[model samples]
Target: MVARYVVSPRGGRRAYPSIASALRAAAARGRPALIEIAAGRYEESLVAQGDVRLVAADGPGSVVVNQLRGTVLQTYGSVQVDGLVLTNRDTEYDVVSCWQGSLTLDNVEVRTPGGVGTHARPNTRATLRNSVFLHGRTLFTASAGTIERCRFTDAADNAVAIIEGAQVSVRGSRIEGSRIHGVRVCDARAEVVGCELTGTGNAALMADTRAELAVADCVITAVHAEGIMFIEQSRGSVDRARVTDARHGVGAASGADPVVRDSVFTACRDTGINVQTDARGRFEDCRVVGARNIGVFSTKGGAPEVHGCHISGGNVGVAITEGARGRFTRIRIEDLTTTALRIFDPDSTGVFEDVRVDRCPAGLEVRGNGGTTAEVTRAEFHDFDQAAVALAGQCRVTLTGVTADRGMLGLGIGEEAQLRAFDCRVTRVSSGGAVVFGSARLIAKNLTVSGSEALGICGRNSALLDITHGEFTDCALVGAAFDDECTGRLVDCSVGGTGDMAVRHNGLVDLASLTTSLPVVRNREPVPLPPTIINVINIINQKIITGPTIHGDAINNNFAWGNDHVIQNQPTEEGPRT
Candidate 1:
């Protein structure tokens, strides 16, 4: 008893002039049927199966289902098209064609000239509320659906295409001029909420096989590519997204594992979060500004986990190379033009904590062509012009409580590098306070070089220094400098207010229990007591009760042999002795 039909192409009373004779008298009243249609052009081609509505007495732009050749509405079991205006002057077919039923378009208005503007076949299930798909190419391919408050403009390709066992839910959507992807999930499962995608030629949200996308609070702007692109083994999560002018404002590669939170990637031409091949992503509290290149890029063997991130103007403010591996925490890299964390793969390994590098010229730049390893804790390097921790090839680093301020060079262990510093601190370094050359190896503990204007620890070729409990204060020059053929071991060391010389051996230095209030030991070229100097410690300018002689061929039976057994030469007392 519920079958109402009223067509009216301007006829008399109980009108039924067009709408295919009121859908053939409401399909002979077999069950559910509405069919209203009254106010304008209707060069129709409608076909319905069971429960059909097709109502638009005088609403959506006053009814206009202008079809030329194929589909202008061809549903199967349950269809409902309110306030109609579905077009198609034959650009190649679809203008609403839901094959196996369940199609609902509320305030509908699909004007297709270049084809598909709603074609949900293959287990069809579509629903678009307050819809509007204008100059289309691909405006829908939903298998299971819900596109609320929809509006897709010049869509030439994918403007919501969720194939392969789909499960779509696009909320409060708005995709403008999409020449390519503006939401395209293949193996399918999408949930794009509060969407707003603008002028996308490619990747303004794209997920491939094994798909699982969940974009929240989105606003993807002018994207030519990658404003969210998770490939192959897709898995996505982008929250609080902004993503401006994109090339890569979120791009997870083949082995995709995307989880970008609190996102804000501005003017990105390239890497503003790009995890490569063996992908593993997790970027939290994100904020990557003007990224022209790397503002978080994990390469081939990708493994990213950046927390509390804030990378600014990037050329390289986090670029873990080819064999990528990363785990940075509390990171804050500033105005970078180059090198503010670049760990080139040797076998790639990075673990940074509490990092903060300001005005970067170079802060934490480890290059490894074969063996790389990094582990920095509590890092803070300021105003770097170069060398605020820069290792070369075959790198291996470990710095705890690291701090290098006003750097020109504060920690630059060259090729063949291997550094292990604990409680490190190099302040006001305009030049050097930790510089080991090729064949580098520096092992320091509790090292503190204060106000360095130059050399407060500088080793040359064959460099290798093992310092334990060090302190060199107010150094303007030499307070520990070993030249070519370098080799060292300075234990319980201390040199204060050094402006000229305080331990400047040519090479092979082994000083134990050394204490200098300030002055000389500039033995530039005379260290021929080789036998590896079993023990030779007497470099005191101040308080030394006695304990400095046990040279090769061991002879220390209680220090009482002064008959040429050499254990007594304590009379070179100079000024400034503490």
Candidate 2:
């Protein structure tokens, strides 16, 4: 026979005198029990030694349970607690702690004393739904648990920690006001979705040492340190998220393989994303802005895939250093005070291919002792104060189909550096044209320099200068000249306009073949022209520009170029050559 006990303060109730007596009577009956609690402050810890259901007359926050002792409810068997406000009476221990038994809680609130937990296991199991865990340290350290539709606040330590092959899931929650990590997965697999975390420590979500984490559709903000950290070979994935006001937004350390996509990091103090210590990662369709350090930093021989990202408003947009190799496609960096992209290799044996930049202080800044190879193609530069491309130390930099406007110096090459700028156009530059200062071999092909102050090609201690198949539209200075101790070879390059016979250099002028062909102009991209320029291309590039460009009107090219870059097709020559 099952026993039912109802306790109410506002009734002539002769059912039970106390809650303990009711529990004892129900347990003696050898059947399922139900205990109803009335609306009042129950400053007691109700222990569930067997299978029981505790129901409250009022909803959550009405029947308050204020516990000051160690653990609120110790579950030995199955227990169900619903619609209750479980508060801490300035407890020296955790407000609600569940042991190994299966516990189900709905519409509950677990509050602590605003102090750190002294024990290792502050709480365990602890499945909560539509609850609030507020003002606790080490609020949850579960062996296995699932928390959904909850809120956590004022936790100084880890809000949720899973260990020992535990599986934890937190969904649709708000975790905030933590000095340390919001959630840490150690030797566990955890999944978090549709949540927001703010004001945490080194990471909002951290996976350490053989742990795995998957985070999706979350917003992390106002953290002093990294928003997400993967360490000790942990595997993690972050998708469709936004992180703001942190140090490094996403950090993969110690050989961790993390995939990050469709994310945005704003106002990061350090690098927006960093891969260190042999970490392999992939980042796609991400935006990194307002960084004090680099936007993306890859170090320690890590291989990364950076695709379709707009990294701007930073000191250094991207830095590939310490013998790292990566493939970057359709990258754009703008409004940088320092180097937009820097590729540094100690041994100079790294490679950077198919990188692009626009509207940066310095589009490309390369420095290292290594002989690295880099290619910059189809890149546009605008409103830069320095050289669009700067090559220093022993490295090879190739520029093709690159355009720059109002550049201080088009290309700045240091000693022992090999540089090739081909099919490059520069407009409204006041300094020396396309090439400047080098001791290594230099080559310029089909280069157009217009409105510059100095020579088109100026070499200080260059070994060989090859100027071939070029057109100089308009220059404010001499077309192409080799300085003292510089050798030159001019083959089939057209030099039409000249700036001034300024500073006649004792070098040869090359005019191999003057060839004129009308430029094939077409509207390569769609443009409505924004009233205020919007940086929405990185998001769109994730969808469009997926293949090679074939013709003027390729069916699904879907490039969103600015209105100024759009040029209509010229009329074809139907009659004789006029």
Candidate 3:
């Protein structure tokens, strides 16, 4: 049986006069011992060993131990401290410390004046439950620990800091009014679950410098900087978090890649979620509401994959720029003041599939020169202002099953770019519909432009427009206009229904089986076709490119635009010239 020693300032009935004498007696007796103290204040520096249990006889808040020069209690054995107030008056000392032992604090309050509240060193194991800390950080250095149901307030620095390969788990803790980050984990692994962090001066939760973090069901609010950030090669996962009124809701930079899922960010001042500077983060099933700046910004080697997310009420919805690569699938962009999505990198494929953008000022933009082909599939744009869909900067863009409605312009390709559209439709266009200019090439198949107030399709400035099986209806001025060294070809195309002219041709244009209302057909004679040319267009728009040594795919023989296909030597209506 373990011996019990009673300690009281007023000595009576075989009780020790001071806690120090009681601890000396327990240590001399050896084995496991219990030191119960009466209601009093003891001024002493103590070292508890040999499986000691320090309990307050009159319960918590009754026993106060103030160490004036050093730690209040340093434990070397398995020590259990219950219902005691531990305080250190010196700034250079800690209230409670465990260096190479197991320590448990239950129902304890640590009040330190300019000192650490609780410290567990590299070889220690600490567990704190139902505790309170004030004006100091609960630090763990290369230690293994768990903090449960603890409250930390008015912290001088981070409320909890875990560093140097520490493995810690904090559950059901509230860290509020921290001067710096609420919780910082560097070069360690931390799992924080069911925690609430409020009013932090810096990032609410930060995992930096190769640390790993997994946070779930947490609330972070009123942060001066990022709510949750991971930087410097750190990777983590966040689930079901709510971040409100932060500068940036979530940020990943400098090789950090965090997969955040099912989170909501509200009223962020800057970008709601930012992945930049070689960071590759994935966001899935998240909602960003009322962001003042861009909703999602990825740039500078940042490659992010966002899936099944909704972004609403931001200045710009999503901006991917400066060699960044972004792939968005099943995303909803709603009611932004600026463009919905912009992709400026030349090497980015900009894969966007099953996206809906409503009431944005502009739609998707793919810009830059010598770019790989960007593929967008099943994208819908509604009520956009100038560019419902615009492709510029000599880039290559491919649109399949895309639709635009009730916009100022629907689908424009300019700036020497090349566009290949398949099964696309634009309706209720107010200003213009399907315009191509500036030495560009637009190869459209199964395209429909209906209910347009101005020109249905206009081509200019050496533009090559290949339209096959297209329907242009309800156009005002002209259905299809080609001019200024434009090479235009239309096969099985119809132009009618409330248009002034069916076809206005001022360039080198050839038409076959064109059904129109009033066709002013010029250059109707059959012209000999040119040779199979693999020239600038092939160089600008090709996935598997060919050079002088590597003979490319012949344009007319193998690849052709619909019925204008040419076989090697098959003689048809248009004789083979190859």
Candidate 4:
């Protein structure tokens, strides 16, 4: 048999005067119970050890249960509360706690001044729907639960906290004006979908300490910290999310990797996506716009695999620095105030393929020690005010099938940088097409430097050049110029439509071919020279039917110091986020 009880403050209509008295009677009866409270204020605390449903006789907000210091309600068995207001001004306890069994709250309002509004402990499940939590956080400590259509506002702590290996699913929730994080997961996991988190003092969503948080169709805005932060080896994924006006749209560090897909980050103060300290996040099909500093920043063992992304209106597009290795493919970077892609410092290598950079001052800049290396293939640099591709410091880079159009300078290699360009085209550059200085080395094979406003190829300041089958045409100035103690072998190269001299050598340039070759622009790679042939006869006497001679042991020994990979990057996974 079931028992029913109605309670009021003054025992109206022969009902119990207090909720505790009725609960005591219901417990004495020892049966499944339903307790209906009248429409009035109740200054009380109640504990239910058995199954019970506590509801207001009237609609929601008609019954106000307020506790001054301690928990207002604590349940050990399955409990359901509906159409009631639970308020507590406790400083050291949860207002409503489910300790042993499940709790279902529907159309309930909880307001706690200094304690948790609701706490679901381990081995418990909390089902909250259409509830309002104000000035308190809902804690799921080592528990499992689902929250649907809930509102959390003005939380003193995180709006919702999932910790201690708990797992929760939150859907269609709105969290606003949180003093701390909107949602924080530590050593736990959560899946938040169709949620809006705004006005958070800290990160809107934080996954730390091996926590995994999956968010989809979410909007996070007005965050003082990062919109989404992953740290301490956390794993997570964000899909179809929009983040705006955060310090960093997404920040990952301490071995945390967040797989971000189909997301948009706009007007972030710092970098759009920041990965550091061994975090290897994969960002795909994302758009980062109006970032103040950089669009994508990966450094210090952070190797992000970014592809199919568009970045614009940032100071710099992407920066991979300080032992970070990244694989960037099909990335379009445009309209930046500074460089498009910057690879700097030691032990950092970037392999860029099918990348396009436009309207940036410096397109692709590589500056580091020999530990820094880059392999760029089929890159397009357009409308850059400065050099399209610039290499400085002591690094090595290889550019193959790269096209630079309408740039001030095409390729600028300086300061002990070694660059190898094969089947590359530099057209409509205002300055020189390929400029090598400051003890740099260039092994240019089958390159076309045409329609340059100035000289085609300029080598100066003790630079080394090994050019083979380089075709220069329609240059306003000289075709090729080597001055100031530059020494190299130019073999099987042609120059045409130069307003000045075809080939000008001002200093001691060891040219193997004084007589220019025919203007036959062969559509093929330059052949490697045999080492035995270069060792016996002088380079000048040999007809040299070949390309850049670096493959041959005779010439490879001259510039072999910058060819080693000091640091190898680990693999980056683009599979579905866990």
Q: Pick the candidate with the highest lDDT.
A: 4
- Stretches of candidate 2 off by over 4 Å are 1-3, 8-14, 87-94, 114-126, 137-143, 345-356, 371-373, 444-446, 499-578
Candidate 3 lDDT tens digits, 474-567? 8776677665567778888887687765666653666676776554433333211112112222222331112231143435443212122221
TM-score of predicted structure 3? 0.86
Lowest lDDT sum, 10 consecutive residues, model 3, at 527-536
Candidate 3 Cα outliers beyond 4 Å, as residue runs: 113-115, 345-349, 518-578
lDDT of 4 by residue, 1-578 (tens): 66889998866676999888888888788888899998999999988768889999988999998989899988888888998899988768899999988999999999998558999999899999999999998999999999999999999989999999999999999999999999999999999999999999999999999999999999999899999999999999999999999999998999998899999999999989999999888999999999999999989999889989899998999889989988999999999998898898887999999999889977888888898999999999999876788787788999999999997778878778899999999999876788787798999998898898776887766889888988888876666666566767667776777344455554354444433321211112222222422221221112111113222366443211111111111111121111
73-133 per-residue lDDT for model 2 (tens digits): 5565666778877766565666555654667788877777665321123344657788777
Residues 88-197 of candidate 1: C-alpha lDDT, one tens digit per residue: 87777888888886889999889876657887777778888987888774444437888898888877777778878688799988998878888889887989998899
Clashing pairs counted in every model: 0, 5, 0, 0
Which stretch of 10 consecutive residues in model 2 shows the poorest summed lDDT?
531-540
What stretches of model 4 exceed 4 Å from their correct place? 510-578
TM-score for model 1?
0.45
- Residue pairs that clash (backbone atoms under 3 angstroms), model 2: 347-370, 348-370, 348-371, 476-499, 492-513
Ranking by lDDT: 4, 3, 1, 2
In angstroms, give how far residue 24 of model 1 lies from its true place. Answer: 3.0
The C-alpha TM-scores of every prediction are 0.45, 0.80, 0.86, 0.88
